[model samples]
Target: MQLTEAHAETGMTLLEGPVFDEDGKLLVVDVTAPEGEPKVMRVDVRRKTSQTVHTDGRGAYTSAQFSPYDGRLYLTDFAHGEIVSLPPDGGDLRTFFSGEVGGAPMNPDDLAFDEDGNLYVSDSRGLTEGEDIGRVVRIDRAGKEATVLADGLAATNGISFDADHRGLWISELTRNRISHLLLGAEGKTASRHTAVQVDGGLARTDSIAVDADGNLYQGLHGRPAMAVYDKYGERLATVEVPARQAEGLESATNVAITPGGTRAYMTVSGPAGGYVYTFDALAEGIRQSNGG
Candidate 1:
């Protein structure tokens, strides 16, 4: 189904995160809404209709993922530098994570959760050449404390754990690269290195998801496509929006493949409007693709 809409009346809407609830409803966030406009929406995948689930004059909710432990939906608030949560129906509005962490301010862009309920957030501070302002932080299972997992990044965007849950993959927007981090004892980063480099002449990668076979569905911002890369960093394939459907759509920001589901649901937005596109995933979708 083709879904499109403009935020307010400005002929613009920026759709960021795409996630699926336990009941199979697709949920997304509109980052370009006007004050008091709805930011979170529940998209009827089968009928291609959308309904507002949350709204606020403040907060740019970038990404949302259902936690494996608590089953609550967790989100990263880029505008407020915080992490928030709500029930599947979008009520409660609990501030899950906020304020400064690791002695540094947070500009959370996205989030991923481990099976143990530990949360990982992308602390996006934009590009600072020669200085890594962005970071990845781990909020413990209790949501009581945080630890800096990886620092020295530029505009860190999407995040996902490997199929085995032994490693993590992060997209560095400013650098147009993907790096893999090996989790050591107690979840500290054991080692890391750039695994894949994108030819983002003008656009970098955004949110990402992993398949059961360990392939990465790398979403793009400023481009109408998603690239697939193998676990070893080999380019598998790229799915691009057809030109007929690309005029008003600027990017395919984030892709979510529900665990035990069939299709890859991509959230897109541009100067003219926002949209959702789909593609058949090469491998079975796993837990990592649901949001992380």
Candidate 2:
């Protein structure tokens, strides 16, 4: 298959945290660069109209999603290291989780919830001074203790569980690999394995989510695109930008596949590339062609 590029719908900035709502609308975190306020933007899947749901006094939103159970909109504040929760109908912003782990200075990059309503956060903490002991934290529904499921990771970024709730997948950014952990049957050890390694030299994967067929779609930073991989870590296919304007790399920082698996949306953060791109999934074609 040949590379194809679709221009962003226009007038978007520093887009990140792309997610799909149950109604099939596309929601993205819009963060203006270097000191811009953060806001949650919603795109009407039917009308294709984009509007802001909420704006932050702090810089752009890190990540966000519409809670299926409560219908509240939750977002991460990268600049302040706080989880901002807004009511379903939109109201005063409140801090959901501020330093859930002992007030450790860190930022919440991505998160996922399970069928049982357990929330998991992909925290990217200190990485420069070797303090990059990121974690997969599990927070109870009552907003109580945030238990560390696992630690000592390399920039833990995005997370999602399998459909059956027996497995979890995490994006280890610094290591440039996805780690799969089998959930314990009865508080047992979470068996872990390398799901897939980033090819083409550390694409610097940002956020990842699973498709209906159990395939994983990862954002390939520094190379404006999404890399598709099977459950067994086989490269299925790559969807990339059509035009490479300059030598400087374009980074696709976040990704979300719609519930139905027909559309895949990714966020780009390059100077000329901070808009979301949409793609139609061809799982059968990708798997059959093998990296086509």
Candidate 3:
């Protein structure tokens, strides 16, 4: 695959959480700024330019997702342990949910919504600080209440629903594998099993995205490649990212495919610097509106 520069290095301390807006513009979170602040940015692919859409002086922002039900952008503030929302038209931001839910601290890392507008959040529980208590919670469409779907996860990070909408996939960063949870009739996790494990060249797995054909794309932290697997968890292909493309391409933190599935955007963060890269996709990505 030919890797192209979507946006050049911007001196971001860490870049993660990439998703395409309705207009096909790419949105990403700058976890920490060079001056030690958190912000969200929007990138125009055709123009090869980016603009800061939102900034939070409180804490680091890790992820952003456009909610199909409310027509707003939801974000996870990892440092403050809260979930906030930004207006679609680039208006003021507001707090959506915060504080402890289910008697556990809510340190949301990544979020995914189901077809019915219910939000699934991965509460990392400050894993970066050597905490192992992680939980996956489900927030209703109204954002009034949250229910814990799964708890005691090593490090709940990337999350996505399958193309078929029959299962939910979550990356266990500390375990170095992906877990597939079968959805029950009531839309809860009925059972879960290991879907993919990093055994050979790869180390920890971060964020994940699914294509229309149920293929999974995973970002490998220790390797300069995105691990691809079929629906059955069988290894399919590995897309090697060129290290020369950026200073720290080896640490692929997140992956986001365009609505057309023709292109993919990724976030790389390491000691060298942080960057966002784009490349041609082998398959069509599942649209976020379809609960991807």
Candidate 4:
């Protein structure tokens, strides 16, 4: 098959972050309101069924990931800038990390983990019209206080470490760019640089993923397409989604690439009501990497 829509009736109102569990199931967060109560949903691809992972009736869980250390799901309560750890099978929920140290806005958005199990969260305080603030925070596994590793950016929305965990790629939504922060040892300090800035009408970049070949796949919310870039910061290809009348091909929010880099998934959330999209390697070879 050439990329067909699956699980259209899952009731995913505003599906953003979709991550795979070790057991081959996909989980996504569904929020009906912008900052309203949200639920974590687990979808079994093989069985074609959906189950509620957890629902708190509090702030919406916009983004999440599975912690390799304890196998628990860590969810981000965007409005409160809190991270909560939930049981793998959906039971007890406890606060993982919350608070603003030194008077910084820790509006956590998306998260990723390093080899040592340290968590990296992208905080988007500049998203609002008057906020004019943003930062990327790192919280080690010891439950200690959080600290801003990078500061004064234009809305840091998504973040992930390179395969070697030596480099970080963060998406700045307002600036339409992805920044590369180089790090060394103890996860202590780093130098920052812009990897790529995609500034077209199509650049509503959100969650991103890096492929096995060190290619970055960025999702564009304004346009139903995904931009692929090489390690040296070159625009390689743009994967187009099948057009739809109401929702378009991709409301193209949070993106996740397969471990092999051969497949990718994006949440299409317009009038389609949030359906997961899969694209294969065939759609990826259409462009050559720009000379870097």
Candidate 5:
């Protein structure tokens, strides 16, 4: 497939999360510099322009998702170890979950909400390698409590619900694999098994997004391609990104598809800056808002 440069060299320190809001605008997080403040950017795909929507002068933001239950935007604040929210129109950010919950530090990397409005967070522990301390926590809709669904993961990063809302897919970065957790009646994890093992140059998987047809799109950290997989852990295709376009980037951090799945967006991160690339997906993205 031919990939087009939707926006490039935008001076973003590091771009991670990418999600389409209800208005059809793509919302992404600018991680800024290492230990630098983070900002949320709204991208106009047609115009190929990006504008800052929310900026936190203190912490780094990683992922952003729009919740259909409350019609608000929820974000993962990595630096501050918190989950925050704000109106879709943009306003003062409010803390949804903070400090430590479920006997673990907050260090959330990415998050996804379940069908019942419960938020699931991947607590990465900020460790890059050889650490089995990562965890997956579930936060109630009221944002008052948390429950650890799974632990002892190697850098839990990406997370999303399957198209049927019966399985929760999570990416274990250091382990180089994705796991599918079966959900019980009350949104609790009943069991989990490795869904896919990423190998070769694209071993390190970061974030994941699903299409309406139950195909999974994974952002490869060490490669320039997005790995595609079927619902039953079968590799279907790999979308190769042009090297010249991702010039200085070291990894593709996140992938997001539009509501209609006609177009897809990806974020590549590097020291110089981050780049957001768009391509024709022509597939309907799974409705994450409805926990699909």
Candidate 6:
């Protein structure tokens, strides 16, 4: 899918979030949509058509996911330093999660939810305060408790859980490495370690998704590709952008596979405009892929 002339804008246009709602609607966020443009778009997977479903006049929507419990769409606002929510119809937009955590800003880049309704946030600010200044936060099922699971990261971007849901795969974008945060029995405390280290060359690690078989899909930014790795950090395959559209669409930011299915989709944007490319999944997608 490629942006039509109707999407022409003056400044940069970035498409990030690529998740399906409860109704199976594919949604993506335009993080840099200029004034008077819709920041969110909905695509019909079969028809290959898209529509402007959300235009709030202002905001930098980095990523979006639907709450499994309530079915409300939640977005990570990098510009507002908070997370916001609304109905699928784009009504009643309201702040869902905000404020500081661990005395540092909540520069949320991407988010995912576990089956038990716990929300995980990739708190990233790109080393604003100091080197390796990212943090991972988890919000309890009740949405009241926001606990810091891990910190001291360099621009942590993507986040997802392993097949067992016993740990989270976090992407350190700056270092081009993925870390596995193995949760303790209580699910609060965790032990972390470097899991997959990639040599992306010009591409930076962005969002990630996990399959039912414990495979991790890591999105690349400077290049139109996704790297699939096993739970043990072994590279499996590289999902590429469509050949015809590979010329100028290098800003591949995220991927979302069909839950329990073999369909994989990636959201990419660049001078050519924002687009969604599809491929076959290496394994069946799981809750971590849908993020709902």
Task: List the global CA lDDT of all models.
Answer: 0.83, 0.65, 0.74, 0.68, 0.75, 0.81
Q: What's model 1's lDDT at 111? A: 86
Q: Give the better candidate number (3 or 4) by TM-score.
A: 3
Q: What is the lDDT of residue 137 in candidate 4?
A: 82
Candidate 1: tens digits of C-alpha lDDT, residues 14-51: 88778888778888888767666678889888887888
Model 2 residue 84 CA deviation (Å) reads 2.0
TM-score against truth, every candidate = 0.95, 0.83, 0.88, 0.86, 0.89, 0.93
Per-residue lDDT of model 5, residues 153-211, tens digit only: 88898888888888789998888899998989777889999989887353488888877
The Cα error of candidate 3 at residue 225, in Å, is 2.6
**Per-residue alpha-carbon lDDT of candidate 3 for residues 47-114, written as tens digits (9 for 90 to 100):** 87877777645756777888878878888887777888888556578888888898867878888888
- Model 2 lDDT vs. the true structure? 0.65
Per candidate, the number of residue pairs that clash is: 0, 3, 1, 0, 0, 0
Ranking by lDDT: 1, 6, 5, 3, 4, 2
In the predicted model 4, the residue pairs found to clash are none
Better of 3 and 4 by lDDT: 3
Show model 6 residue runs off by greater than 4 Å: 4-10, 128-130, 242-244
For model 5, the superposed segments whose C-alpha errors exceed 4 Å read 1-12, 33-38, 126-129, 200-203, 289-292
How should the candidates be ordered by TM-score, best one leading? 1, 6, 5, 3, 4, 2
Best by lDDT: 1
lDDT for predicted candidate 3 compared with the true structure = 0.74
Which candidate's TM-score is highest? 1
Q: Write the per-residue lDDT of candidate 6 for residues 58-157, one digit (tens) a residue.
A: 6788988888777788899887788888898787888877887777678888998877667889988764655787889987756677888888899889
Candidate 3 backbone overlaps, count: 1
